[model samples]
Target chain A: MEALLYNLTYGFSVALTLENIFYCFSGVFLGTLIGVLPGVGSLATVAMLLPLTFALPPVSAIIMLAGIYYGSEYGGSTTSILVNLPGEGSSVVTCIEGHPMARQGRAGHALAIAAIGSFFAGCVCTLVVAIFGPLLASVALQFGAPEYFSLMVMALTCASVVGGGSVLKSLAMVTLGLLVGIVGTDVNSGIWRFAFDLWTLADGISVAVVAMGVFGLTEIIKNLGDDEIPPTLLQKKITGLMPRWKDLKQAFAPILRGTAIGACFGPLPGLGGTASSFASYMVEKKVAKDPSRFGNGAIEGVAGPESANNACSQTTFIPMLTLGIPNSGTMALMLSALTIHGIAPGPQVMTSHPDLFWGLIASMWIGNAMLLILNLPLVGVWVRLLKVPYRLLFPVIITMMGIGIYSLNSDPADVFLMAFFGFTGYVVVKCRCSLPPMILGLVLGPLMEENLRRALLISRGDPTVFFTRPISLGFMIATAVLLLMFLAPVYRRARKVAPAEEEG
Target chain B: MRLKIKSTEDFWAGLIFFGIGLYAIYLAWDYPMGSALRMGPGYFPTSLGAILSAFGLAIIALSFRLELENPAHVPWAFRPWLVLCGTLVVYGLMMRFELGFVPSLMTLIIGCSLAHRDVHLLETALLSVFLTAACVGVFIYGLGLPFRLFWWSY
Candidate 1:
């Protein structure tokens, strides 16, 4: 505890520098801005802004990016409450209760509770990361190739089961992503595997290009094809931005429950913010005396899920910072950011880069505090931003995307590659195939293959070695358990099936 | 006329997966596939390709098992597909030719805005100018990216 305090103080000393603070504020402010916009999401925004970070110091860049990450969580709920359109995947739950609250004269109430709950959850989860990050890193130090590979397997399977789509489609998407991930020159051998004689393909596809293409460009196409203009649900006046005392009292238990759920799920390999929020919503509905009030304007509905999502988003850093493995696409993008800075994330990150680790944790607290200040009083400004039509906004977005892609390597081929992914993303979405599993596969497949190969080589090609190792065996058992858990529900209620649906 | 499948989603999804999987397998076939103890560059890719093709086959089988009486309509929006993709192709070509930033950016904005009929020419032109200025300010002036605004030398 004493060491943690001392480390945090050192972290604050670094993060409190005027330049770093400015970047953090700018990140959260920009994050909230995009979160208010309908089509833009946290992942796409981070990908788009990644080029700018290359100019700053790595520490400042990461702090700013992390700020934008959780700050977007605050801004995401704003659109969901004001308009029925969720700015991102995790905010979809917020839309269920938040939009209803807006339809009534309780928009301010919903917004206020979301902000407060998020702030509370963010603080708690930041602490969780600070406490668990080092411990998890130590545990990860014991991980061999077999253990890491098994962990990745568990993550992919759990994500697929909870991914809430056709299991076959998700699996196919994952496999396709793995293929795409390996398209560059094989690292082991100097042979080009899937380059098709193109020089650029030898370097592999940029993660930013993939993200902007899939999330940003595909969203634009979908919105353009959508002829109907979404009616603003904020027809009622927001009387007050502060919730009543009774409402706060009613929200307290739900917020605590959400924080617990988020903290638990956030560090897991497969489950992330969206899954935690969905799980918290289920818990809230189950515990509530009037379960029927869930889909409506229940304050508890907004409080629990909003807090849960924020908690989950913060906890996502644990695995990324400790294990150097990403559970979600957003975390994968962050891992890419760390890599671009020539900092390999894993157990070594904590010991080798103490300033980076502690400073990031400290900056999260400051960033969350900054977000609460920006989100509450300035909620009206974000609501006004929603008035910009899709036509005017989309052109600017596409232009920025083009510019962002060009800035990466000055290769226009990257721009074309992004467009290709955009088309692919649209096609897959149309088919009701989840892109998260595919993205997870794309990000982790190469790493998994490397570990599996190493594990096999070490064990002299004994496939049974995976089952023989204790940690690896445990991970495989966990994966099997998760599979059975997801399947048993379907088997039990064959006729009435309600799978959890998520988009990342 | 295009071929209409009974299960449009499953059929198209399956076909795409199968095609990609088969192509991946073909590409990895020639590479050395050593034993698991001494894995070659091709070993992992070949196995993944095989698994992908198997998944593809299973999905196609599922299409038949879950066949619908009234087939799902395939709303393949070709106009957006052409215009959206064409914008990037044009932009890429312009960038390759060193046409500079502003012109290429204008092409992207103007070209993609045309995909949807609702865009006003005047408004789009205004947005392009505003965005170009913003990009030059933030990306060029602020971030100091070494990109010429107009390629004045040309």
Candidate 2:
């Protein structure tokens, strides 16, 4: 406890610096701006701004980048409230009640509740990190290759299950992602696996290129292809930024429940903020005295999912901070950012660079506070952003994406790769395949393979080592349980259908 | 009379996965597959290829069971596709030739305007100049990238 307080004090000293504060403010400001704009998400915005961070101190750079994340979460909820369009996947749940509330001219109430709930969740999660992060780091210090491999397997399985599509299709996407991940040179053999003689392919496809393509360009193309222009924002005047006392009372419990659920799920690999929000929404619906009110401007609906999403965003840093594992595509990008700054994230990050670790925690809290202050007063300004049409905005976005990819390594090949993935991503979207599993698979694949090889090397090629070790065995059991939970219903339904077919 | 593909998504998705899996297996065929105790690079790829093909087969099987809500048609928007691709290719070619940022950006904006139904030449031209100035200001002057504003600087 003393050590945590001492480390956190040191972190505050670093984060409280004038320059660091400036970076945090700027990052959140820009993050909120892009997040409020439909068709552009925080992931794309972060990818675009990644190059600018190359010039700053690593601590400031990471702090600013992280601020972009939470700031965008806040802004994403704003868009969900004012417009039916979700700024990102997690915010999709928020739009159910949030947009309905907007249509009913209670937009201000929904926006205020979202901000309040998110701020509360953010504060609690920061405390959770301060207390539990160090403990988890100590636990991670005991992990070896077998345990790591089992953990990745469990994460991948859980990720695929929660992805909410055909389980087979999600697994296929995961496999494709793993294959894509393997396109770079083989680390052990010094042989290129799938480079196909191109020097650019030798280094493998970059995360930024894939993310921008899948999320940004693909989204624009999909929007353009759709026959319908997006519905315009509710024209009613937003009244009463502060909710009634009774409404706040109703929301308080759901907010707390959401934060708890999100914090629990956040540290798990593969299952991220999106899953947590969805889970929280379900819980809120089930627990509400009147469950039917969920989709019809229920304050609890907006409050619960928004809080859960924010809490999940904060707690996700736990695994990344302690174990050097990313829980989602966005976290993968943050991990890449840390690697670019020459800081390897894992157990050693805390012991080796205490200030960077604690400073990041402190900066997040400050950024959340800034977002709350900025969101309420400037809600009107962000709503006006909805008036901007798709045609004018899309061209600018493409230009930015082009320039961003080029700036990464001054390689036009990256741009071409991005365009290729963009088209492919559009096709994948049309086919109803989820992108998250593929992304998670892509990020986790090489790491899992590296660990599997190391484990095998240590066990002298004993495949049974994973089953033999206690931690690895535990993780494998969890994976089995998750798979059965997800697949059991399908099996039951298939059996019933078979009987019906025979009788017919 | 014929075995028809019931689900277009599954058919295409399965085909793509199966093709990629086969290609992976073929690529890794020559790599040494050492014993599991001393695994070679080929071992993992081969295993993954087999697993992927299994997934493909599973999906393809499901295509027979699952019915489509509507017979799938090509989801392509030809004009947007052509204009977007053309603009990107032109921008890339210009960058490859070391054309000035202004000209390249103008080409991109003008080309992209064709994707929309209502194209105002005056508005597009104005948007081009504005966007070019903004890009130069932010990317070049603000971020201080190494790219020269004008090609003639060489």
Per-candidate interface DockQ score: 0.67, 0.56
Candidate 1 local lDDT, A50-99, one digit each (tens): 66676678899899889878777677788888888876667888989988
TM-score winner:
1
Give the alpha carbon lDDT tens digit for every residue of B37-78 in model 2.
777878888888888988888888878777645534656765
lDDT of 2 by residue, A221-301 (tens): 766776745658775567778778987998999999999999998887656666788789989999989998878999999
Docking class of 1: medium
- Weakest ten-residue segment in model 1 chain A by summed lDDT: A494-503
Pairs with backbone N, CA or C atoms under 3 Å apart (clashes), candidate 1: none
Candidate 1's C-alpha runs over 4 A off are A233-239, A291-293, A486-501, B1-6, B67-74
Compute the DockQ of candidate 1.
Answer: 0.67
**What CAPRI grade goes to candidate 2?**
medium
RMSD of each: 2.8, 4.5
lDDT of each: 0.82, 0.80
Report chain B TM per candidate.
0.86, 0.83
